[model samples]
Target chain A: MISIDWYLALSAILFCIGIVGVLIRKNAIVIFMCVELMLNAVNLSLVSFSSHYGNVDGQILVFFSLAIAAAEAVVGLAIIIAIFRNNFSVDITQINLLRW
Target chain B: MITYSFIFLAVLAVATALGLVISKNTVNSALFLVLNMVSLSGVYLLLQAQFLAIIQILVYAGAIMVLFLFVIMLLNIDEEESLFNKFRIKYFVAFLLGVGIFAQLIYSIGSFSDTLPVVSAQMAEAGTVEAIGDVLYTKYSLPFHIIAMLLTAAVNGALLVAQHKTKPLTEEND
Candidate 1:
């Protein structure tokens, strides 16, 4: 039987990858994808814990999290599109109009 | 069998995530994210989250990713520059910080001496759609309604934000 630690470890690794992606990548969409990866990693851990405890609460939380993620994606992509419309680019470094 | 499946799904998940990061083309990155989401759903199934497995594929892979791709195509963005062409000290520091956070998480997880409880029949039932609906409707009903409202707001907000506004004819004359 696989230990829950293994799943948790995997979650950590995926989350870290997301962090690195977010930090190093310049494209706004890629950064958004990295955030999604981090969210999925958390969902994986939550599901594992829910199974470990023989309870439904964690799964319920995951369900809510999934909904929120979808909503975030919709709004976030819309914002990115709006930015691209005005700026003609999605590179994060280039969209520094607010930088003083 | 389960262990082997877990290992395979875990490796696939990590690999696709890395692919999403490393690919230069935004379209390729989007495709990689789709693959990553699919692999994660496989992991969800391994964890006995049957309902979530389906939702992950449907909501994430099916709906959200399609939106990403649609925007990518609609925008027709150019491929990004090479990853390290403009590497700065700040990026290196960020990488180190990510590594530090990962190590901290791993160390904390390692320090836990107590093993997770074995999966019982009740745990298996908790993953079912019926069981989740039961709890979601009863104990978490308010949150459920809130989520519905949030979704509606998100849809309206996205439409409002993304709509193209025509420039005033007088402003164009200026």
Candidate 2:
């Protein structure tokens, strides 16, 4: 039988992988993708817990998270596009204007 | 069928994540990210969070990633052949962060060996759909409304930002 522990473990592993991607990837857009990955990982964990506890709280929380993620993605894409248009590049290294 | 589906999705998710890392082109990375999101949605289904799984596909794979693809299309990104240049320090920092997180996870798993057996039966008498609506209305109603407000503000902010095209100040000086 498949176990919730196993599901939780998988979610944890995915979360770590996403964290690595966010920390390591040099492209700003890739970093944004990694952020999405991390959010999904958290969503996995939330679903697992909600199911395990027999409550709908997890699902509702997931709904809120999805909304927040959508908003974040829209805003992030807009900012990145603005940056890309001016610099003619997508690599995070080149957009170091914030490094005062 | 369940086991096979889980294995396939798990493999696909990891592979696509690797694809995201190895591919040099922005468009390719975005595509891989979409693949990863799709696989993740499958995982969500296995967990019985059907609503969440659908939202995952619609929001992440459908809506947000498409926006990303369009931005990639609109930008000056050419097919990058080589990305490993003089940016060694950034690579090192990312590597360290990954490794550190991995180590912490391993240690936590090791310490959790005495965990109680995972309860197989979900306790709530009501189904997942019903329970979720109840909690959202009762315990989490305040936060739910607040999140809606936050999302509205974000949409307005994005629209405002997109419309403001700040031309070069030098051009304005003439």
Indicate which candidate wins on TM-score: 1
Q: Which lDDT tens digits does candidate 1 get at residues B1-174?
A: 988998898898889899998988889988988998898888888878899999999999999999999989999974866653256886887789899999999999777536555354687788999999998999999999999999999999998899899435665553
**Local accuracy of candidate 2 as per-residue lDDT tens digits, B20-117:** 76678878988998998899888877766676777788888899889888877877474775654456776787678777876786566556443343
| Worst lDDT 10-window in candidate 2 chain B | B118-127
Model 1 ranges off by over 4 Å: B84-87, B166-174
Say which docking band candidate 2 falls in. Answer: medium
User: Lowest lDDT 10-mer window, candidate 1 chain A?
Assistant: A91-100
Docking model 1 quality class: medium
Q: How does chain B score by TM in each prediction?
A: 0.89, 0.81
Lowest summed lDDT across 10 adjacent residues in model 1 chain B is found at B112-121
Best candidate, lDDT: 1
CA lDDT, every prediction?
0.87, 0.75
